[model samples]
Each structure stands twice: as C-alpha cells, then as structure tokens.
Target: MRSTFSAVFTIFVTLSVCAASPFTKRAVTLPPLNGKFDYQIGGPYTPAADVAVVTRDNSASPVSGKYNICYINAFQTQPDAASFWQSSANAGLLLHKSDGSLFEDADWPGEYFLDTRTDSNRQAIATILNGWIDTCHSKGFDAIEPDNLDTFSRSTNLLTAADNLALAKLFTDHAHSLGLAVAQKNTGGELGASGKSTAGFDFAVAEECQQFEECDSYTDVYGNNMLEIEYTDNGISAWNAACKARGSAISVIYRDRDVVPSSSKAYHYQEC
Candidate 1:
C-alpha cells in the first residue's frame, strides 16, 4: 500500500512539472502577416498574411486565407453601438456614470467599457463573446486573439485586476474547449504570478514590446511563445537582438501604424 501511494504521488509531481514548463519550449512557428491588417474602418477583406484577423462584420468580404482571426469587440462596444449589438441586453455590464453617462477612452472616443466586476456580468459577457469565438472557430481561424485584455485598467477604479483576470480565464477556457488557442493581446507588461497564471494561453500577440523595453518580460514569462509587431526600424532591431541573444523562438514583423492597404503610399510591411 505504501509503494502504491508513492507511485501515485510521483506521477502527480511529474504531471505538475510538465504542465508548469516555461512557455519557451512550446513556441510555434508563426507565418508572416506583414500586410494590410486593419483593426478599424473595415472594408473588403483580403488575404494579408499566413493569418489575417479581420472584423467579423466584414465577413461579407472574406479573406481567402489559410488562417484568420475574426476580430470581435469582445471587451468593449464599437462606436456603432445600436446598429447590430444592442446595448439594452448588456445594460448592467455597460460602464456608466453617476449620471448614467458612458466611460470613454478618448483614443477610441466613442467605445465604452463593460462592467466586468460582477460574476453575473462577466458570465453574461462571456456568453455573448463565446458566440464570437465559436464563429471564428467555424470560420477556420488557427487561433483567437482577443484584444483589450488590459482594458480593465481603463475601468476607472470600477474594474479590478481580479475581475479582468477572472473574465479572461472564462474566455480562455471556452476558446480551448472549442479547439482554438487564444492569445493575451498586448498584456506583456502585466504578466506575473498574480496574472492568474497565464497557463492556458498558447502564445502572445505583442505590439511594441521592443520600444517599451519590455520584451524581456515576455521572453521570460511567455518564453518563445510570442510574435512581435513593431512599427519602427529601431524597434525591429531591438526585437531581433533581444530575441536572438536568448535563443528565444519569436516571429517578428514590422508594419505601418495604420496598416494601410497596399494601394496607399503610407503602406509598409516587413518580416524578420
């Protein structure tokens, strides 16, 4: 009986060790996406990279590509609030003021935050966003990159870090169950033990990691499970140096801030 107990204990330790392995060894080869990939002002879809993430509303114009990341405003409402996504159903979760005005992120001026504090609200948001993740799965995306994980920080003391992490875990588990890996978009700076264990995340879609001098945090926490997008040559060079020196596995790409279509003179794309 003692021997049997020891064997079971050993097996448990082995499984735990394997599960906790650093993100480096699990790195994947990302195909180039150095083309016009728009996050706003959606129009006709075109295959831009090995993967193209386009807004779901633009599904009318499909990008005939190998992999796609259908963009859903999973965390917040788009400027066109009432057209298709009615705010009435999600009124409780929508950010509001004492006077009932919406909380605004001026850069994305019109979009308002969703109150992700309560379990009920989070689950409600999860249910709706799960539909979007399912749509991406049905549409054949290799992965789902849910933008604005950091938006809770923009929640004006109403949204706690714990609230964001809990909601993120909800979405992450749902995505995986549907057989799609999800990414923690642009949260490279916020990863830690308290990050609620970024365990289930497959990889990261980091923007400007080099420019922020925060690439090392990602390389350490996420290991090679990263794809960096830089908007400047200096950032690209720094990315290469940091990633290469650590023998880390990372795909790096450069793009114009606008990611303007090839028809535009301001269009820019690069891969390294």
Candidate 2:
C-alpha cells in the first residue's frame, strides 16, 4: 500500500512541474487571453472604461489590478536624447556617422546605443536601465518589454547579436528574479532560433509583426503568447486572417505608430 501511494505521488509531481506558466514558472498562461489588450506607451494612467491591460512607458508609476508591460529603451538612448549623453563621458556606445552626427531613429530621436563589449561594461551600461527595471518590479508591473534588441543591425555590425543576447538575458533574468516577466522586442534576424532567447522572455511584444511577415517567426516560438500591435488597417487584416485560419487566439491591439494616447489628434486604438 505504501509503495502504491509513493508511485502516485511521483506521477503527480511530474505533471505539476510540466504545467507551470512560462512567466512565473508556477502558473499556466494567464487565464484565456481576452484578445483585446491595450498598448498605451505614454505611461500608465487610470485608463478608460475600454482599455484592458495598460502598458505605460518605463518612467511612469506601475499599477496593479491589470497586467502592465514596462517599456524600457534598453538598446538606444532616450528620445530627443542628444543632451543626455555627454561626449566626454560616454562616447563608445553612442553611434556616430563619419560627419559626427548621431544616428537617430527619427521617430524616437532621443535614444542612443550602449556599448556592450565586455561583461564589466555591459553591467555598467545595465546599471542605468536596471534601476528602471527595479522600479517596474517594485511598482507592481507584471512584465517588462525592453525595446531595440535588433539595434545591432542598425549599428552596422559594430554590435553583435551575441552582445544583445547577453544583455537580454541579463535584463530578463533579473526581472524574473523580481517576479516580473520580461519581453523580447523585435529582432527578426534570430529571435526564433532555438535557445537563442537569452531573456527567457515569457511573452513577445511585437510591433507591426504582421505587416512585416514576421508573425510566423514569433508565433512559432511563443504560440499565442505573442501580443501583436499592428499600426495599420492592412496589418490588422493580415494578422487576423492568419490567426483565424489557425484558430490561434493571439492578443491583438491597434495603435498609431507613435502610440499616442486618446487625447491627441494622432490617437488611434482598436481591437479585433
């Protein structure tokens, strides 16, 4: 009788271990996805009657009662960001053209690249972003979305994917340690590669993934855990068709490219 009881207990433990969520490693993927989560980057506010999960910029205070993704500009400098980086103090990470002009994203001109050549330097660079991560964890954020993992391609190969993998893991591991799930932003070059995601990212927050033919790459790995934000009508149509055909219940949100709030003329929001 004792032997039979022991065998049953062992089988139960195996099933429990296999059922944990990718984020907490304890819970399974949070309830059934509602399919209409919000993506608001202007920083979290009280949110309106329609907004589902509120996503704020990394600078805002985190809120509970909803799943929040802290948007940290991990790879680049701040938007309109020239004044932040002093040339005399931090120069190597800052990308410069032959004419000494900075490489700005135009949309987010403030961001600058961080030099991640050595572990020591990477940690030093991470120090700035880690504080924000710490704040996100403490402020009640459920997850983090560190943007610009693909900046290495933009860096003209001065930065390698290996450099990003190291940093990505560093950020995600630390976030997980604090009980916050981390997200991998765009990097079509190698995001779906086996075991290449150093971040141990729980879910993927892709921007215009449908418009770019990259949805397949992410959905293949994250399953329906991919939270897609389509910036245009055509993108929404394309993503929905693919998702419906597969019976995949992916969460989709539509926002302007700028992702401005409802108060602005450029304000755009939708869910399907």
List lDDT for all candidates, in order.
0.55, 0.60
lDDT of 2 by residue, 1-272 (tens): 00000000000011111111233333313313544577767533466565446667765755555667777777776633444454554565566656787666544445567766567656655655666777776677778878778877777666777877777766665666567777666664365753235557776677767666777777677776667777754556765654454334766766666666567686776666
lDDT digits (tens) for residues 93-144 of candidate 1: 7777677887765567666777787888877777767666666666666566
**How far out, in Å, is residue 75 in model 1?**
1.5
lDDT of 1: 0.55
**Whole-model lDDT, model 2:** 0.60
Q: Candidate 1: worst 10 consecutive residues by lDDT? A: 1-10
Structure candidate 1, residue pairs in collision: none
Model 2, residue 108: distance off in Å is 4.1
Which residue runs of candidate 1 sit more than 4 Å off their true CA positions? Answer: 1-65, 82-86, 193-199, 232-248
Instruction: Tell how far residue 147 is off in model 1, in angstroms.
Output: 0.7
Which runs in model 2 stand beyond 4 Å of their true positions? 1-35, 43-51, 87-89, 96-103, 106-108, 194-197, 233-236, 239-248
Candidate 1 has a TM-score of 0.72
